[model samples]
Target chain A: MTDIAGSATRVADIQAAYLAQARSKRVMNLILIVIFAALLIAGFRTADRRNAGGFWDGLPNILDFPADVIGEAIERAHLLPGYLIKYLPSLIETINIAGASTLLGAMAGLVMSLLVTRGLGPVPWLVGPLRRVLDILRAVPEIVIALVLIFMLGGGPVPAMIAIALHTTGALGKLFSEVNENASLRPVEGLASVGATWTQRMLLGVVPQVAPNYLSYALLRFEINIRASAILGFVGAGGIGYDLRNTMSWGAGKFDEAAAIFLLLFLSIVAVDQMSSILRHRLTHGAKPGEIHR
Target chain B: MSAQALHQQTRRNFNRKRLMSFALPGLVLGYFAYIFMAFDMAGLGVRVNLENARTLVSDAYSYKTHVTQDNRTGAVEIAIEGERKGAYAPGTAPGWVRLGETSEIDLGGGHVVTFGGRVTYDVPGYGLVMAEPGAGGVNASLPDGALPDFISLSKNRLMVKTDAGRLTVTRNRAEVFKYSLGWELFFFTLDSPYHGMSPGALFKAAVNGEAGAIWQGFVGNKMWRHGDVGWALLETVLMAFLGTCGAAIIALPLGFLAARNFTPLGGLRFAARRMFDFLRGVDGLIWTIVLSRAFGPGPLTGSLAILLTDTGSFGKMFSEALENVDARQVEGITATGARPLQRYRFGVIVQITPVLLSQVLYYLESNTRSATIIGAITGGGIGLLLTQAINTQKDWEEVSYYIVLIILMVMLMDSVSGWLRRKLIKGNGGGH
Candidate 1:
């Protein structure tokens, strides 16, 4: 009986220690939560203080601009189709910028990925420097290049295209290199044994293996590039964004035009989003459900 | 299934592949041709300003010192980059310039310029180019030889450009610009007592109790505004952090509403999902424009715009994650007599916390880049400063500086976010 009692007390002591640890852990988590909350609050307050308008004051007027634009758009509903037709060319230009940049960037990225991949690379010493170059290219926002180019090249779509392409090269190069690392080197070795050039080896041995994944990533980059190109247009690079800026700056009178541009942009983005997602899904999954293979 | 039939099929496949190979390149070339025309590539050559390119390239790495003399008063002034902020004090000038009745500027390479009642540029290869500026306009004379292409003389203006320097004479003033390497007044302006100190001397000064003063000089540099730039960089980073974290926080519960397994109500899920779609589809540019209209402009507007758009993105992603959560964990929690909320806390939240945190951290780094672009649109943070510097067109050095800082800022954020993701989501086994 004394032995049983001693065992029970020992078990109780262990339970007490576990509970204490649990309690301390909870307390530490609570403190961390408190600190995080404090940081959020402080950061918001600082941002508000630095802002041109206060949050509360702006909250009520948040919907006012949208409402006004929508109201005018509805009031001038008949002109909507005409405005859409008018801006169609600009929209096409924007899409072209995105598409061209994606194509050029993807090509550049393919070269860069092949150059940087450990197994495929010709010059091992260049890999680190090339990676750093990509990082720098990625780090620079498109607007910086676009704005600088605007200074030298003047306001046009070319600046935005170059800017977006440079960024896409960096982004897609990184992704492509990651894809490249997983590729089998047996084909490359076979090609080398057959006396193929470096270019021929990469094109034949690796390109076929990673083409699907590369296409999927490039499609995603194209989607992003569309948005980037539009944003660049807002800052004096030519396109629909330029038109939007002009209409917006025109204030109340041109709200209808602004609305029209907004609808067009929204519809295009959604369509692209849907189409690309479906394509990506198909690429990854090989085919749709119950599709005939013939 | 005969050998002949199989051979025919193989031939067809090979032919189709060959056709595709040729057709793809042809199509790509065709598209490029179309784009070249559409984008007016032919006109771009004419549109490109080589002079502006030269200025931008040179100004990014080099600065010019200006020596100017008033024709009426003969008051001479020496300034870096010809900015009023970089003016030399009275009775003081660069070593190459000798301040006297006639300010004599040694342009190096045996080229010299003197500015007073008369402006004289003594070119080493050529003879003296003299110009007298008065109310009657600049009367100029060049050496009695074949005039070099670098010298241009007219009734009102006389200009001489050489490898050493450039001299321009007009009725109102005579100015000589001497080109030099490196950014001048980068750390301390002319007013700072430690302006001309070498790095070794600066260290010695700091050791001798002048560290604070030296720091103040650097921070308060009239030419650079390092302190303000630093604050702007911080604001940009803060915008990204606050926006990303706020979006994640706001989206977590909404995600529960949108997820099929969590919400149970089809109507509520549809509504929530549609709201997410709408927010995301509107895009950040539109949000920024709309928000800036209300909030005027600042880092707050930028952050809010980021928050609003990212909330949509996070909502969709989080809901998807929630829908994929393992039900076994919830069952295990429930077997312990845990309440519904307790089950969710232990099973659902715990399961998705790593995913949510990693996604949020990833967005934080990307949003830093986005914040910069948004900051430009909304007139806040370093983007504002960068845009302003670029807009001026004359401040290429400042533009380059801001570009370097932005690159560093983004790389720093990239590494930091990557580090945090690794530290926080270890052993979670979720796709980043």
Candidate 2:
């Protein structure tokens, strides 16, 4: 009894409370476990003969002859350091695709965001359907949009740009609206008190507050678009992916070269990401009270 | 016009900054319209329809078959294994042969077969086979041999022609030869049965072709595929989750450290205030890829990546929540001379647990959605599935199905997370 009493009362009480919570959550936990199990079973059950002629074949291909892959990679690795320098052309292209797409997407997102912002639009006519459109727009995968755009633009940088922009608008628009919604009502209210119209208050007061956030989000979208742009070439959009398609098609087993490109891309993204975080921190935490960006 | 009327005009211009409200939406719509026109939706629909028609034809197998042996126009063929002789109609269901590499057909009874995607794709239809010439290329360019007498009649008048002495195939495996984005788009599309001509296959073909040793040459670097695309997707998710958890863990301790009402030591509280500034200053992706390369791949790199990224994010969120907490309970802890950790345990942590949970759930939802993309680049998980899909262009309908599954998984996670947050933070389900 003394030993039990010696235990910290805070720890014991907290444990007791946690246990109470867990006991109540048992039903839910069990239900989730069962649901997850069922899903897993269904997925596995459905997984039939794989790699009839796709990535699955790579396994058999690998096991059957490791030398082919290894030999090519080793040989390619010799020339890869020099080939790595060649990534610049694609990198520049990627920047262009991302920049153009982000510019286009931000414009669309800005409009849709404003229309859907409950605080700004308030009226259902503007808010309701726009929100649904944004939802549907986001619902479809970006690749599908890319596929559809390929039809129109005929598979160059243009289709990929348009596809990225469309999806980005929906995603960024949602974020923008949240920024608008959380916007301090003080400035807007003060503007209204001075008899400024709804539109006027949003501009002089609302726009200024949320601009930094919008910019940050737009920059983030650009980073994403850059990645998307690089991949678009798999479908013939443009960039280094076209080269990848060819290399894989050749099956010369130049995995080392492919691996190098991958390594570089990952590193570059990391750099971009660091910059974004710093920018976000500055925007959010730098300013004082009302000076803070929405 | 009076002087007052002129003054009113200037005031109107001042307030007219609101004009962006009306002009802006219209302007945005105008730009959207311009983009839509630029995409040329009508042309793309036609191309897709053409491609779909070709696929539908191949899949449907609603064609008549005819074979000419040397000069025998009408088909009169006999099998030798059991010496079974039979007269077959020119156009009839032969039975099914497994049409795709992934899709296997029984063809037990006839040529009609059933198939499915890892699940079941058994459909009733005849898969025509070239009887005499053997199952070879559609176009018979067999070297040093006379054309054997066999023909396959498949969907859309599937017919094999013989040139001089070789069998010829005209069916389009891919339109990549077209020299347009259409060809690339066709190749880009995943979800097809044919494997050889797809981007991945083409690469393999080039590798195996005379260009085998080109991989070792300066020219070899041109083969650098978008392999990293796979890992990027994995890296994104791993970092997002771990970073978030790290942030929560750090914030919990620091939050207590900063809770002035709970901690009589103002010095410790001041230090806590600076934790968020330090933590939240870096992006999650940066943290992950750097770690991945440093640690040399796998979830460890991803975990560290997430830890670095999320610490900042969660620290910010948590500190904000700490500021809004009620002071009364915290003050009560201070009045008792309890250690700093004890007061925080009693005062801040308990109070903000619900808020922390809700935010975590929200972040998890976001991270899960983004996780696929990171995995794509990092060479791990389902992003691999997606990357393979784009690279191979095997069959997109199946890809669509997978996409739907992922979305449902995300939605399920979101709902469950929300429910847990609600239940835990504001508990009230018990009679005890």
TM-score of the A chain in candidate 1: the value is 0.91
The best candidate in terms of TM-score: 1
- What lDDT tens digits, residue by residue, belong to model 1 across residues B3-40? 99999999999999999999998998899899999999
Candidate 1 per-residue lDDT, tens place, A86-127, comes to: 999999999999999999999999999999998789999999
Chain B alone vs. reference chain B, TM-score for every model: 0.96, 0.51
Quality class of the docking in candidate 2, CAPRI style:
incorrect
TM-score of 1: 0.95
Candidate 1 regions off by >4 Å? A1-25, A286-294, B207-209, B427-432
Q: Report the number of the highest-DockQ candidate.
A: 1
Tens digits of lDDT, candidate 2, B104-151: 334233322222211121112322322222234232222234433444
